[model samples]
Target: MLIANYLLTCGILQANAASGMAVHDDCKLKFLELKAKRTYRYIIYKIEEKQKQVVVEKLGEPANGYEDFTASLPADECRYAVYDFDFVTEENCQKSRIFFIAWSPDTSRVRSKMIYASSKDRFKRELDGIQVELQATDPTEMGLDVFKSRVN
Candidate 1:
């Protein structure tokens, strides 16, 4: 009876740990979605932990010229500048690919930037496509003049 109770308690603890991770991941994804919404129209279709990615299906065209819009922002307001570009997925011939310019939360300078896509295939495809451009950049690294020249 004691052994049974101990096993049951362990099971409950494990379940609680898993639940906590899920809740934490959900909150992070929701925060990213909110940040994306501030600059562009986005719909978060899925968030997968195993995949280690968030899949956002863009709802409509970007509100303003992508570069100009990001460039015009005040440094302290956003955590990351997210950009969406086009790509061809196997399931859907063409889809939007999202990337993030991770910022230092206080300074808002680019820490790094990366393709925040759904899967490996999409990430590879984006890299392969020569014409694909970064739709977002650090306002500090590339000023408005340089950012304008790089936009697609």
Candidate 2:
């Protein structure tokens, strides 16, 4: 009788485990669907704003056809590509500029370039340093000029 009871308990545990795995798979599928839907909506909005043209001009054009632009976008650690350009200012301050190309996964071939600027601080935290000088200078035209140069 004890052996029969043990076998029954083992079967019940296996069944429960299988059900739990099924539930986990279903939840994962739902999450991916929701995420894809959200990304699609965002792409549509960006297209309406003419952001696609801006991205294309910055990146020089996508290697793949425009129809596959969305599929070319990076996911997680798989970014499309990155380009970095560093320059020295008149005040002897060093700054790094980065451009990240993000593509869509749909038929629109929509793309965008995310730009970033950072001052290189070599001496940690010093008051009279290059980083401080860069912060004090106006950065209005720096980004625009850099972006325009990329298109050419």
Would you list the clashing residue pairs of candidate 1? Answer: none
TM-scores for all candidates: the values are: 0.28, 0.19
Worst 10 residues of 1 by lDDT: 109-118
Instruction: Report the C-alpha displacement of residue 11, candidate 2, in angstroms.
Output: 41
TM-score of 2: 0.19
Model 1 Cα lDDT, one tens digit per residue, 1-152: 45435534755222222222222243345435534453443222232335444444232235545555444444543322344544455565765544433333344322111112212233323222223233333455534443334442
Best by lDDT: 1
Residue pairs in collision within model 2: 70-104, 70-105, 71-105
Per-residue CA lDDT of model 2 for 1-152, tens digit only, reads 45435534755222222211111232223223323332111111111122211111112132332234333333321122232334566677775433333322223221111111111121111112111111111223224454445433
**How far out, in Å, is residue 55 in model 2?**
20
